[model samples]
Target: MNLLRPFSLLLAGLSLAASVSASAAERIPVVASFSILGDIVANVGGERIAVTTLVGPDEDAHVFQPAPDDIKAVSRAKLVVVNGLGFEGWMERLAQSANYRGAIVTASAGIKARERADDDHDEHGHEGHDHHHGKDDPHAWQDPQNVIVYARNVAAALARLDPAGADAYRKNGEAYVAKVQALDSWAAQQFAQIPEAKRRVITSHDAFEYFGARYKVRFLAAQGVSTDSEPSAREMAGLIRQIKAEKIKALFFENMANPKLLQQIAREAGVTAGGKLYADALSKAGGPAPDYLSLMRYNVGQLLEKIRLN
Candidate 1:
């Protein structure tokens, strides 16, 4: 009865598909080193960017091995963003392999870097030998205030690349910065409710020094800064003694780290392991800590709930 209707529908579908392709083509291609940084870039760039994250959710970037697809993504990107501060030791090699000529933006560019110290050393005073990234603790993103700087940096970089979208980028960056500031204020208030003596925590690695400094909470780790570093038996023994003597009860495993080590520590110290903290990466899309803002809130909430037990 309506033989022409099917042909008309097919033509309309093709037009819609072409429109979508054009829209995607108009967006700038951006490559982020990890999921958390990719989320920040997405917030800052908004609809103007198509972001490709090399390190997916809950994946370790410290020992990440880029595949051929990653190289292609980098090569095709108009811009690439990294956490910097030695967090991406493999980034340089990957870029070389990709022959990426685009600008690489360091989100933590202007922030004052935290230098690795005794926090990276175990109880027996053994330091991490993998200081290939130097003495800087690459986990600056642990601090929400630092992320404000990250938003600003990403905005500036994107503005430089896509000058036409400068206003949009700035507005987006400002909005993101406001959200981060609010988060920082809330976190400060939350920590204020806890006594100074109960603010101490134990984790698998020294990835929270920035967070510790920001919130004034001390973090003791079983291993050093990098996850690749193994703790000596003497070091673990010393840590166990300290945990027992100090009665520290807030122990957590990072999302990207091996939980076995922290689990063993908890068992030895006779303390129940708390919920996992998002340190180096975000959780999956459906998980609690899917983005940077959510990640911080989840971590702070978890820490508060558990540290109260100390």
Candidate 2:
């Protein structure tokens, strides 16, 4: 009945316009392939981006099966980030299927990957599923220097997606790098404290090659990089023999992975069971290793703690 209320109508129009503008201004939606990518994205993107991870911390990304939801997420992402270098084998197909048009950034773009253990042919004379970090060890983040490259790539990608927030991403990435550098220093310092001979470790898997290379730790594994591959009984016997011969101080288990094999090895080797280490994924929020930084810190700390005690 109040058809003449022009002021009220004008006020409603302005309110609706403001709401629409706010909704449109919401930060760009970003999706990272895995936890490491997600962590870098969160650090660089900060609160201006909505970051989602496909394989969360502590979950194995190598054998990860991309769910339908992940495909949809990638299809809708503003900028999709992956470690690339063949890390996510399913990623290429998913991206192709989704027809995602956004920039797909390879965080390891500048990284020089490590050589595959068996650079030869598979049993079938074809390519083997075994890898050296997706051909170059997408786990390059294990090396702090490589992490610098990752942060830079992430910042650059975010800047491309949302130019207005580029400065924030760069600033945050630099600050986060400082923190990572500190962690690197602390990890090195911890290893420095242990005697060179005692620095040897036997892990459930080969996830720590970069870390070992960086920190002077000797990590021997019965199996290859991924725990998915089962080590033969002969391989286990050989490992057990080597462990006894070397007198390796402790045997370690990955938290996110099954510890049964490591436990069996420990029992057979007659050594103390070292504490859990975070390798593939980060621990859940309530657990010790929740984030990338904390995960690194906790793993090294626990390794040191157990080695020192034994």
**TM-score of candidate 1 relative to the true fold:** 0.94
**Global lDDT of each model?**
0.91, 0.78
Lowest summed lDDT over 10 consecutive residues: which window, candidate 2?
Answer: 118-127
Per-candidate clash tally: 0, 5
Model 2 Cα lDDT, one tens digit per residue, 12-124 = 99999998778656968889988866887798888888888999877888788878888888887898898876677788788888888878899989888865543321221
Q: Candidate 1, residues 1-310: lDDT per residue as tens digits?
A: 9999999999999999999999989999999999999999999999999999999999988888999999999999999999999889898899999998889999999889989866546454565566556889899999998999999999999999999999999999999999999999999999998898999899998899999999989898887788888888888888888889999989999999989998898999898999899998999989999999999999999999989999
Estimate the lDDT of model 2.
0.78
Per-model TM-score, in order, reads 0.94, 0.86
